[model samples]
Target: MTSWVDMPLCAVDTETTSADPNTARLVTACVAAINGSEVDSRTWVANPGIEIPAEATDVHGITNEYVREHGRPHDEVVAEVVEALYVAWESGRAVVAYNASFDFTVIANHSPGFEVRGLIVDPFTIDREFDAYRKGKRTLADVCEHYGVRLDGAHSADGDALAAARLAWKMPRVYHVLALASADSLMESQANWYRERQYSYIDYLRRNNRPFDDVSVEWPVRTQKATAA
Candidate 1:
């Protein structure tokens, strides 16, 4: 039994300019945890080189103009974020993300020029694996709604990431009870499932008749405007 206290874990989340991991730029990143009644948090914002679209800006609040004026260099900030995340993992802790595939893919796409190694516990995939037969979908919001978890900050990277961490903490103990597999095993299982079964997570939810609610109806204030100066 892995007690939450015994688990060296960090929650990670990223808010990007778009949904495409290959093209979207990471605008914000955050890591946080609640340890025995004590909460700790860290966050960073970067100026992705690509243009921050109006639609994207409407969601995250970062604009190209503001980024140009106030944001740190994208690569430098990403390096810092990676360093912080790696430190947490190297210390024998697991990095947790709501939908790790999205975040990890984005990181990998942007980090081709750098090196990073760690296993991320993507609770999204885990939930789908655990609830494969339940029909519909298991989005972070849906899961949070089903489990009575309060989702704060919506699309803000830190807020979403922290919510994910809490959800990971509350994952039904039944999961941990099964074979105590390594993180690699879990990832492989998810990848195999995705490859073998063309399971679009959205389709899974629709089939299950689970309600799909938009996690963010409107963006947060984290983004800046790049409008005419």
Candidate 2:
């Protein structure tokens, strides 16, 4: 039986135009394949066919002018990204991301025909579960720092994605329980972990008289509304 650490890992991430997954447009994306110590990465930049807001550009450092000059067509980039993910899945590798829900949701919305397969690993969810009581932020940079993983470019899709894969590789070494679980089991566990976190936050909101409806428990990607049959 292949241990979790020995299995191949495919990490995906995207830099988008907004924080809301429903509205954000993908500006850049990266998919990385990791086998033991070797990694191969591919990246794409697209002119999302919409304005790249100053705020979004500030985070990812990709300006509208720059993308217009260098990026490929939006649909073309989306297709390639989807194909990369499909290849990774077909290779029996686990797909990883730091905050998977946002990245996967944006991609699903953009590439409507693309369907993701294989095990999904989320370092963000796993970190929350393993260190539930730990204080402060849990951003990719923070988690990488905690695990002593080098994150060179910070918000760039390629940098963040590779760092996430490295962090996932380090997780089992730090948490023995993670080493005991298979990829499928870990995926299911992450779903439950996210649900518990959302419930706790909802309770806090209600206690403070704040609106807390519409929270989702889905992992990797939230369930979208179905078309009328």
Candidate 3:
């Protein structure tokens, strides 16, 4: 099987009203195509049917008034985003996302019938597997800096989506393990990696006698707040 490094990639990202995926309302999103060269993407702004908090607006620079004036209806935007993902998946492009669970979970909650199809390559998970002990924040900006991928727009969905794809494309070059494996293999490995990390954190929480009930071990998305370990 050919490595994902040599294959076409589909990347996604969303900017929302809150940092928590379960409660966040999508303000903007982008679906991008990453070939060997660069990312080409389509972006959307949605009214989200709610106020965009000052903090959230500060992060993404998307205000409620901006969306209400220029954005599509929430449902319409979500449907189009899902359809774009379907188009990429149908073309055999593995979805590239940084901390995919957040974006996927948010979209799934917004659209009840949304289910992930095809392969997912999450840089957030894969980076940990490749360099388990690196000590720094793994936010998209941080990871982009670590990988030497230029990130021009920090919080905007379109820029983040493109940057994530660029980082994923750079991973295989730095980690031979990633370059040798197929997308299916990478996806399975990431699932185990995420599960193992969850169990380890669960153990740490138990040792400290802290709350551990809300952690979800599901990869790509967790439909609800549940743990199985």
Q: How accurate is candidate 1 locally (lDDT)?
A: 0.66
User: Candidate 2: what lDDT?
Assistant: 0.85
Error of 2 at 109 (Å): 0.9
Candidate 3 per-residue C-alpha lDDT over 38-155 given as tens digits, one digit per residue, 9 for 90 to 100 = 6678999999998999999989999888998998999899999999999998999988889998999889988878877788889899888888899999899999999999887999
TM-score attained by model 3: 0.94
**If ranked by TM-score, best first, what sequence of candidates would result?**
3, 2, 1
Best by TM-score: 3
- Give the worst 10-residue stretch by lDDT in candidate 1: 216-225
Candidate 2 lDDT trough over 10 residues, lowest sum: 220-229
- Best candidate, lDDT: 3
User: What local distance difference test score does each model get?
Assistant: 0.66, 0.85, 0.87
**lDDT tens digits by residue: candidate 2, 1-229:** 4556657899999998898888888899999998768889899999898999999988999999988999889889988998999999898888988989889888888887757687888999999998999888999998898889999899999999999988888889899888888777777888889877877877777778887656666677877422111
Per-residue alpha-carbon lDDT of candidate 1 for residues 18-106, written as tens digits (9 for 90 to 100): 87554677888887754655657788878887788889889878788977787778877777777877787777666788876567666
Per-model TM-score, in order, reads 0.76, 0.93, 0.94
